[model samples]
Target: MKHSGKVPDFQDFVECVEKANSGKINTKVLSIGDLFAWKDCTSKQNLKCRGEVPYARDMVKLTAERGITYLLYSTKYDEPCSKVLNFLQAMLMKNFPLP
Candidate 1:
């Protein structure tokens, strides 16, 4: 984000969600990337993400801040979103284990 001004990054996602949730309300969550993309993209893309922008981590961090858990991932594709969700969630969970 600092160097790559055009493309988005982790901080960018955080800022995007923060700006989107701009209000006095302390309880709000938003995510442009669903659970599938959130978890999958994190590893696939990581710091070298070079595809469409994502905001799943933004949503995760935002919700986590508010002590929210159990994020349900949805997909608009034909291949069951739950299947993708399972893989993606497992991928992310492996790296970032719950403390």
Candidate 2:
């Protein structure tokens, strides 16, 4: 993966997973941050940024569709914890509704 100081496209993330599943690459860990780092709000001026929403939704959709296991790690200092949690909950409910 190219670490060109830019977040990779969602397709890049899928390719990485495919490679790892096929044993073509050694990906020890994958985080939600790695996929949405491009949308990070680096400045307090943009604290209300919701740029990662669409990406997060897509990630959930793709993972559910492919029956892939996903792990999410959040740091208390990254952003508002409630927002992250709420987003995750909504995504999970929408993609994997509980009967």
Candidate 3:
């Protein structure tokens, strides 16, 4: 499985998740990104952030393909961030209905 810290882009993120869903990753915890770094990167690369939803959908499909359970955990302290996370979670659930 491709390690998380090495994820330079969306493709890498998809690969790591796919590996985990496939049971090829034995690590108990996979560090995908630093929260602060992710926030900063998103701010600087706003255009690239447009792919977030598509990437998320890809992850959902891959996880479902392997019957792997997944969840989006948010630690945002503000109301707006919480709302955004909730919306994203809803969209994911809508796109990938539970069995």
Candidate 4:
């Protein structure tokens, strides 16, 4: 009953994330660069960018306001991701109040 090619669904991914987060993914992240190349495991797709430093900073502030312990950012081939990680590690390691 299929006449045209169809794309795969991401239902499994959604389920996985929900389960992994234990139905509570309070911690969020702001990816400022390519964050999918690793998923692809190749350079066929381009996803490099720069802006994670400021992004992470903003995220930290937001998380504080929202009430979270930590933020996560898994990026690949992203200059911003590298820069932000370095900056976060070097500085901004203080207590943040939540709402």
Q: Best by lDDT, which number?
A: 2
**Residue 47 alpha-carbon offset, candidate 1, angstroms:** 4.8
Whole-model Cα lDDT of every candidate shown, in order = 0.39, 0.42, 0.40, 0.35
Candidate 4, residue 49: the lDDT equals 33
Measured over all alpha carbons after superposition, the RMSD of each candidate to the real structure, in angstroms, is 15.9, 15.6, 16.7, 17.2
After superposition, the stretches of candidate 1 with alpha carbons farther than 4 Å from their true spots are 1-47, 56-74, 82-97
Order the candidate numbers by TM-score, best to worst. 3, 1, 2, 4
Off by over 4 Å in 4: 1-9, 26-99
- Kindly report the root-mean-square deviation of model 2 from the true structure over all alpha carbons: 15.6
- Model 2 lDDT tens row, 1-99: 453334368766756565654567654456877666543223332323545533343333121224422333334444432233223333454465322
Better of 1 and 4 by TM-score: 1
Worst 10 residues of 2 by lDDT: 60-69
Q: What is the C-alpha lDDT profile of model 1 across 4-94, one tens digit per residue?
A: 3564566665555455534443433446653334323334433234344334652232112223223333333333323122222335454
lDDT (C-alpha) at residue 4 in model 2: 32
> For model 3, what is the alpha-carbon lDDT of residue 48?
46
Error of 3 at 21 (Å): 3.9
Cα distance off (Å), candidate 2, residue 46: 40
Instruction: Pull out the clashing pairs in model 1.
Output: none
Residues 30-57, candidate 4: write the lDDT tens digits.
3644454322122111123333234433
